[model samples]
Target: MKLKKIGNVEANYSFWQVLVVCSGQEFLDSGEDLIASFEINSPDVRLVLCLTDDLLAARELLKSLAQKLIALSMYELELDGDVDDNQRALPYQIARNVLLQTRLPTLLLESCSFVRRDITLLPAELQKADCALKLRFNRKGISQKVLTNTLWLLPNSRVDRFLAQAISGMAKTTSENEERKAVYKALQACRGFLKVAALPGRYADRSHKHEGFIWVRLPKEKAETTAAREFREKTRARFARPPEVIILHPKQDLGTKSHLENNTFKRRVERLARPGRIAWRQMARLLVELSWERGKPARLVPLPQWKITKEALKNYEFAKTIFVPHLISAQLPHPKAYYYMQELVPMLFTVDRNGWGGVDSI
Candidate 1:
């Protein structure tokens, strides 16, 4: 897999600088008999393997096919990986652990429903995973000490089978070693974005142990404690662990599960969802308005409560809660012009753009 530049070919934001990808292999065994497994060797790390749901049906079909091949003096058996690699299938081991363990059930509960005072629906079966490993897409890039803080956010249900097929195609051509390396790189990059942290400078020989931080964002409109973030914070507050937030967007009403429509719709929505950007613009404006009301050029200003615009209410189904932290930084050069630009959520620990690096300590 290679990290490719995607979205907004002419966009100027620093966040849009990179995107990484890896081939997903499950598509090759789609609709066929397959078994996925995961191994929980460490209490800190849990690896999961997913397999085809039609394992029984594939077994039956294979039996009949095998008999016909045997009569032709060409006995054959379909196998997942090479005999050597099969002996070390991590996903298969992980799958078995998931089936036999009670912890999986507990974990599944969190993923069952997207619940909130305002946002009622969310994605299901989202998993939280953490791992520390050396990652690199190309030799030229630095391999800093890397950590993976992962949550399987909402699925693009529309791209289900087509995504599977795409993965299968990639798997057929790419070497397993190369694929693994590529996936590790992509995951590391994703984690860095969510945490507002830096990537590793180099690969470490020892297995990097990562930590999992999962929960929904706190809705600003509702009472703050009822938010998903509060629950996670309560659990790990004593340890002062770093936070990772994943915002999921679930499928609204489409019926088809194949990737074709999902990808098509995803592309269409990305174009139409300029509201997300617009919302930020409004936030920036609100901050400026508040600053002016204070009668000073303040370094920070609170974003005023947003009014639900009629145009936005017509298209979006879910209620959005715009959160403005105590600090605000206008990316625009002139403080006066900052009011016109879009505003991003301030980092948890950052007072402003200059102190963003200090966020982890808080």
Candidate 2:
């Protein structure tokens, strides 16, 4: 590959300065898995065998995937302790830790996502945002938001300002290694802070800040949290060519799940599934119970209620109370739902629920 220079920076080469992360082999099996069928030049992306102390484990995986990855660029990072709550703070803390240390902008992405186009290949709208998040629609409705999903692209400098402050506050009280676990644990509650505050539209007075945040929808073919950004990118590409709506009738609706028409319509809807019947039935009952107990108008927990300032968040009571009835969710987050019928919820934590248990996806 050859590089061209423009105004002192390498033209296409410098644009996609990414730090691809594999939290465990479970998160990203290999670098090639990320690009999948795409024809990505190795020079365009950087890879990391991230988040495990065991170097030998990292080395073995890299040795196997040598066809797609450079041996030198894939390095191991170890955080102390089990620190293993998939929904909590590991990925954010990992990104925050790396971002604070590095000068270039780096995004945290899982191993399963297919990069049909590289970050260097992105448009100006996506490039300039404070954070580019993948989003999913919750059960409430198309208009209702669940939470931000996978494949987050946050600026290293901006992450320093938004994420690291809280981590630093706790660093004084804990050992460096313990801080890794603590940051993630605290992040469970702290996520409410970002979802409510850092995310632009949760409040009225909050700034949209150039409409700089992105919340992309996921593909129907795979698991919801897997960050199938390529699906929507393909849809956007299709729109530019022509508008072709393929309508299907009741008889046209295939009785079979694998019919071509059914698949096409599924793609158009973007959300092919919803939560299980049991979960919905259970949720209805819980809502009834809440109504009886409150005995008045159902309280509204309008977010952005707490001032979006460092001091307000750093205060003690905010974390504990954020998810209380009028705050985030109304229902007592009872037993974990056995399986979600839809793939709406994101990785960090489920929306509206305060406790740190994960909602299983269909």
Question: What total of clashing residue pairs does each candidate reach?
Answer: 21, 5
The number of residue pairs in model 2 that clash at the backbone is 5
**If scored against the real structure, what TM-score would every candidate get?**
0.19, 0.37
Question: Across residues 1-362, which tens digit of lDDT does each residue of candidate 2 receive?
Answer: 11111121111212223444444554434444443212221223334335343446654554454433211133344455634344334555566665554433455555544443222223232434545442333344322232323333444444455455534545444333344334334344445433322322211111112222222223345343333334444423432222111100011112222334433333312221222322332332243234335542111111121221234323222112222211211223322211112124422223233322342221
Output the lDDT of residue 88, model 1. 21
Give per-residue CA lDDT, model 1, range 35-98, as digits (tens).
1100000011111222223355544543443222100111111224422223122322222233
Q: What 10-residue stretch in candidate 1 is worst by lDDT?
A: 35-44
Query: Which window of ten consecutive residues has the lowest lDDT sum in model 2?
Result: 243-252
The regions of model 1 sitting more than 4 angstroms off are: 1-266, 276-362
User: Per-residue lDDT for 212 in model 1?
Assistant: 18
Scored against the true structure, residue 317 in model 2 reaches a CA lDDT of 28
lDDT of 2: 0.33
